[model samples]
Target: MPTVPSANPAEHLARTVDIVALLERGRAMSTPVLRAAVDRLAPPMNTVSSYHFGWIDAQGRPAEGDGGKAVRPALALLSAEAAGAAPEVGVPGAVAVELVHNFSLLHDDLMDGDEQRRHRDTVWKVHGPAQAILVGDALFALANELLLELGTVEAGRATRRLTTATRKLIDGQAQDISYEHRERVTVEECLEMEGNKTGALLACAASIGAVLGGADDRTADALERYGYHLGLAFQAVDDILGIWGDPESTGKQTWSDLRQRKKSLPVVAALAAGGPASHRLGELLAADVKSNDFESFSEEEFAARAALIEAAGGRDWTSEEARRQHAVAVETLDAVDMPEQVRAQLTALADFVVVRNR
Candidate 1:
């Protein structure tokens, strides 16, 4: 299949600027002042989070400009806007999500032995694991600090949703690390892992949206489910792309997932085949990539594997599930609890996530 154009991060940045403008006009939470404070709150651990978010220079000095895409922040804001609170009510919490997401990336790069992130040397590559771990730890602490300022949030309700998502994010990462050693995983377990690794934060984004939306319990639950399936779709698509995407277009190696033996969705689907593909993969497990050719599979062979993922229904299945969750997400917004236009916009963003190239 031909690769469609990837979404432009610069254009997405412009849209986010628009969204942030809308949130600022409502001016519910003093975000400018608070963002300033968070920037100043901690300066230790080499400030990798700050740099990752483009809040500071590589030298730990303050700078101006774009942070990593802030997709989670957008989801949090959109969720709130869809919920009708103007997203300003949830901006601080949204910022926490962005920070936390980057925090995970910093550590993930280290654990995965990735060298580059967003086209630059990864935190660990620049600073070593000990310092990278400290940086991630500091960001985690900072995320809680930011969350606390959310102000009188109901522990009985909104706060619980927020904290639960954060806790689950850690749990999910732990599961991903554990998968490095496991020889086989059932599809059901894979779904659970995706839920933890990918779904949890997205659920939190929508849950935060609902809380700020002033939505009731039932609608909030629906939104959470929407986020869950949306995340699953995101991960499955990522899994497929990991094996076949254009390294230049996607900014990742096509064979990296297979090389690292990640057991992504496509590989997972192929493993279910119980034939040559499965047999080959099983042999690769607990084995090292010794030769330069790595078993003589051509680039075209990898491309076929990508098509196999789509043909075997791994991609289609996840996409259909995303659409289903999207409908549920729309239903939550349509509940007369929120404005129609805001809900529609957020719904569109959900669709965009599934199809976005990167």
Candidate 2:
């Protein structure tokens, strides 16, 4: 992983402290509010949401498990600070975004038929698809309720932003599902889908806090741009991980995306880069398409496809694109004037986004 940038010893220590501290800080600040929001659900939904959040086990016993990285909440809080407001001012934004994020996860696991996440049974797997759909709907409602109840102009603005992003996210998911059945998905098409699916919500997260903190549109827009590019970088890295990441860390089986025949960035780029290896990779993929025999694919078959992707420079291209997007994300920050400390923290978070393993 890349080291956090440091200008001087004292600044470095401050940046490091801020960087490490914000994740825990965000979790601490957002969890109670999020739990309270989840508690609004009736009966089994409450139980299911609680279990999904890792606050309890499947048997209703209190047990701590991995929740998530809390990246959105941290960004919300940091964005508040960037707007020259107290971090506490961003708590509602933090909780709302976190709620929206988990809502997506619940639905995504069910839609994608993913049985595992964070090394545990997915809500859909453990609780069933009915509960997953119900609880996801409940969470989405709760996210809007939390924001709209604030009853301020800024709150109204933030709600509109969140809803807009949610619509785009849904659109992206639709595009993703549609792309799966098609034989050819262009690199441009893939980026657009990812930009909507991943980038839209991240842009909202990056600016919603500032909106709630009463920031002007210019500053909020700049931060939104920062987050949009950061989201692209994040998804690119994620595509790479989907193919080559360690299953133990990723909480998925080996060759996970390949098993699903996901046309992620690497796969699209590899097919776009024509060569002997690329042609062979295309043949293999075309054969799989015709057979529709992903389940019967042997370990060696998946491994050979992975190797072909690498030899065709798919992996390297995606990696370079990640760095390029990261640069753009960081550069967008220049348009906003905020505390120096907050700037460093946002940059650190952007670094974390591009370099993160999961």
Maximum-lDDT candidate = 2
- Expressed as tens digits, the lDDT of each residue in 1-358 for candidate 2 is 2232343223343446555577899899889898898888999999999999999999999989988888899989998999999988889998888888888889988888888888899999999999999999999999999999999999999999999989988999889888777777899999999999999888999999999999999999999999998899889989999999999888888888898888899998999999999899998888888897777779999999999999999999999888888788887888998987788788888878877887
| Candidate 1 clashes between residue pairs 3 or more apart in a chain or in different chains | 79-209, 80-209, 83-213
In angstroms, give how far residue 278 of model 2 lies from its true place: 1.1
Where is the poorest 10-residue window by lDDT in model 1? 1-10
Residue 220 alpha-carbon offset, candidate 1, angstroms: 2.1
> Model 1 segments beyond 4 Å from truth?
1-38, 55-66, 286-336
Model 1, 224-274: lDDT tens digits are 776776677677667756766667656666666765556566656555656
lDDT of each: 0.62, 0.88
Deviation (Å) of 289 in candidate 2: 2.1
